[model samples]
Target chain A: MQILFINNDGGGFADQIKIPDGTTVSDLFAQRMPGRNASHYLIRVNRQPVASDAVLQPGDRVSFTPTRIEGA
Target chain B: MRSASRALLRLAGKIHSRVESLQPTCSDLLLPDADWSRCRAAGRRLEKAERRGWRLAAVRLRRELRQAMEQLRLEMHRIEDRLTASERPPRIASLREILDDLRFLPDSFDEVRWDLRQEMLSVTTEPIVLEGFPLGRFTISLDWTRIGFTRPYHVLAREPNPAASDEAVTHPHVLNGKLCEGRGAVSLRAALESGRLVDFFTIVDRILHTYHRGSPHSPLSEWGGVCCPGCGDRLSEDDLTPCERCESVLCLGCLSGCPACRGLFCASCLEPCAECRVRTCRSCLSSGAGCGSADGSECFDGVEPCEGGRAQNRDSEADTHALLPV
Candidate 1:
């Protein structure tokens, strides 16, 4: 299955990447963001906040936007 | 009920048209800043390896260095040619992607509105508290026409729960509704140029939620207090003072005392003496208006003390002393 991932942190790109059919939201985050704490990001599926273990679906639009970005 | 739905749809349609109108500029706007620092670093590393290889004078080591250099050379060549182009959404794809972003998360997003008369696109955020300081809700209003010119957006505090010290500053980076942007400048610009409404709003919201102690306009810890603008030390309103002349808020430590009158004033309130060149308050300067020495020294008219004694009282030493600042 392939899903559109919008990583609003570094690079700020929207990329389509293949994922396992049964991959959960946390699984996808772990693969793409490796080592970064999941709690630091506001993970959403199709524009709605979702549980960490929510199962991914093909053609899903997932965005991981950080809740806190410092301003000087 | 149906009429309200129709009105919302109409407003959304108008916003969609506004986004579509940006197609001509997107091509230029989406071009990311080129970063060649890594490529230069790689070249420097290769040079270091080559120098070490020459020092060893080992044939095997030299061969390994040559292979490494060759690989680096190829990579540099590609960079030189700029072969690694980032993926830019095609005009059609960008249109679709951005339209979705504009209307997406309506349930979660407090309000995404367009004021037709003002030509402003605004997104209201939920009340945001940072470091236990309630900054209140903010409206990130973007004037699309000014997007590339001036910083197009103003983050206005809706409820105006400003820091106690400075009413003009609502957030660490926001002063009088204008955001300093800081590190978020590039991404905010990119999102606006690409018509990514959600991303634009998301970045603004994040900035509101986060507070960096070192870089704040006024730190949240001092939200209920004020700081001396000159020295940046936290001080109570009673302890702090203002520049008498310009009314600049400052701490006592930064006060300047007039040499003549011994009265405290700010830099702007003090004038240099014409003779001594010492800064003095206006009342103490020798301006020739007040009684003083003939050469204008010791004049309280805010000018330098003249060496010559006052013409009216050269012999009368008592009067000369009387003109002197107490």
Candidate 2:
């Protein structure tokens, strides 16, 4: 299955990635960013916030935004 | 006519002329010493003439004096009207009129532009310098008609040269590079009406400064640098999660997430399932029991029940199964 992944780290990079069936948001986060703390970022599925245990459907638009971006 | 009678008539005419001349100085009538000595002298002369067999001349003098006094009273009224008119403040019927009356922009703003069609005013502010942050220029857009009615104006900032360490744009009152202050339009209107453009800018500066000083690791970060609505705890620039349904800023303790849909909810909004110990929304429960139960019988929580005999509970213990960051 394929899903749209958007990372708001730099340039708001967005792309489609292939994932196995029954994969949760936390699993995807671990695969993408292994060492970073999951609590540091806000994870959303299809523009709606979801828990780390939320099951991702095929074609789901997943976004990972930092809880606190550098701001003045 | 007798000599005394003729003299009384002449004195009466002089008193009338003197009173007429003092019409312009009606305001001076209220003073301690005014130029009414000639009128007083004429009255005395008329009284003596009447006692000395000039009764008809004295009567004529009294009539003339009364006429002059009536004219002077009218003149005082006219002067009062003019003075009151000049003292009244200029009437402003609309926001455009107020802006038009402004002679110059405040020093904090670089430029101001108005769009009559949209009833919007855009102000570009001078570069704002904050500690440990790049110089930023703020652009504010105010909807003149709705400024103090619906919501406060929108604010956006642009940094010329962003810091290399963390390039992601951020603001204390900003979410996704957009200002999200929970202020009413009344405050903005008050600032504009009072001509306190500097005060408005000061408020923006304070929001940015507070956000810059906040630590992202704390639970206060999600509050957008505002106090929590529930416990009144001041929130910093950390990851305070807002309620998913209503978007109310919340602290970690105040936020509750549904287990079935995995959506975040506020303390007052969270509902738990009766059959399974999962927090579910009313809509989710109504459509179908998302708890993957086969029978779908008697699965109601007491917090918020669906159309059927379902009951829901807003139990915080359900947080153990919630999938939120906290």
Best DockQ among the predictions, by candidate number? 1
Where does candidate 2 stray beyond 4 Å? A1-72, B1-97, B160-169, B176-189, B192-202, B209-326
What is the C-alpha lDDT profile of model 2 across B63-95, one tens digit per residue? Answer: 545534433443344344334433432122223
Q: What's the DockQ for every one of the candidates?
A: 0.39, 0.02
Chain B TM (all candidates): 0.50, 0.31
Off by over 4 Å in 1: B1-10, B17-106, B144-150, B163-167, B221-326
Native contacts present in candidate 1, fraction: 0.49
Candidate 1 per-residue lDDT, tens place, A1-72, comes to: 898887776435566889988999999999999999999998989878899989999999898887776565
Best by TM-score: 1
| Backbone clashes, each candidate | 14, 15
Model 1 scores what on Cα lDDT?
0.65
Model 1, position B190: C-alpha lDDT score:
50
Alpha-carbon shift of residue B113 in model 2 (angstroms) = 1.9
Q: Which docking category, incorrect, acceptable, medium or high, applies to candidate 2? A: incorrect
lDDT of 1 by residue, B243-308 (tens): 666768777788887654456687778776555556666765545322234333455455434442
